[model samples]
Target: METLLQWFDLIGIVVFAFTGVLAAGHKQMDLFGAVVLACVTATGGGTTRDMILNVPVFWLAESYYLWIAAATGVISFYLIRYLQVPMRLLMIADAAGLAVFVVIGTQKVLALGHTPAIAMVMGVMTGTFGGLIRDILCGDIPLLLRREIYATAALSGAATLVILNDLDVLPGEAVVAIAVLVTLGIRLAALRWNLSAPIARMRSH
Candidate 1:
């Protein structure tokens, strides 16, 4: 389970970094700016998770995360210029990265013997914060603020993992897989159907 978690973390970093690159391209940032933003987008949530959990910051403890972000940014720079990527690619990447990181964060908290509630919060945090940071840096409205079922999807996945694990209904690996699929499915469904949270108007005084 631990090994699988590490691999998921690495994959999350790569996907988030790629999203950062895509955002940078949209903003017309130069290479240095793109790389810096990519690193921040890739690791921001995990770094916050570790810091609040009082664990070592992931990139600082292992250089691979930052290196992967840089490599991804550089590669994506050329790929974007050559490939005719569609507009929705970023959304797909964001959904994937969100699912992966949510599992990583929730499982990490559970493995540390924390309560399921805290684990779920950390999971949502880890999933959404990186993209929040990316959108803010790119001068766009953050997805979390949008009507889309963003953090809600992360929360759903975290809850599924916690519930299934508590029930002991499946192996840990299976739990993780289901959690990721649940998240990815909800996100994709929302995108496909233009689903969103309803905004309520304020009551008159």
Candidate 2:
């Protein structure tokens, strides 16, 4: 189980790093800037979660995560130019990373003896914060601040996982897997359909 979780973490790191690289590419950043952004985006969320939980940050204990992010950054920097629409690639990678991180984050909080509510919050933060930081660094409006269904998807998935765990309806791994699928499905659907939350408009007196 630990090994499986570690693999998932690595996958999330790589995909988020790819998204970061795309963001930096969109800004026409140099190689060093791209690498820095990738590393930040890949680890930012989990780092925040760990700090909030008063635990040791995961990347500090595991150097391989940084290596994975760096490698992904270098690879994406070269490959991004070949794509006609790099932003589309960024969205896809972000969705995948978000899904994986949500599950991992919820499980980590639960393992730390936190309540389900706290777990869900951490899960949402884990899934969304990296992209938030990436966007801010790239000079784009953060997706979480937009009317899109980004963080909502993470919340829904995390809530589902918490509910399933409460009911003891499935194995731990199975529950996590289903939550990830739910997140990914919702995010992808939103992207395909241009779904978004209704915007609030202030009426002039």
RMSD of each: 1.3, 1.2
RMSD of 1: 1.3
TM-score of 1: 0.96
Q: Lowest summed lDDT over 10 consecutive residues: which window, candidate 2? A: 80-89
Q: Model 1 segments beyond 4 Å from truth? A: 203-205
Q: Which ten residues in a row have the lowest lDDT in candidate 1?
A: 78-87
For model 2, residues 1-205, the per-residue Cα lDDT tens digits are: 6777788899999999988988888889988999999999999999999999989898988888989899999998888878765578789889999999998999889889999999999999998999999999888899888998998999988998888888997887888788889999999999999999988999999
lDDT of 1 by residue, 1-205 (tens): 8778888889999999999989888888988888888888899888888899998887898998899999998998878877866769999999999999998889888988999999999989999899999999999999998988998999999999999999997988899999999999999999999999987779999
| TM-score, predicted candidate 2 vs. hidden true structure | 0.96
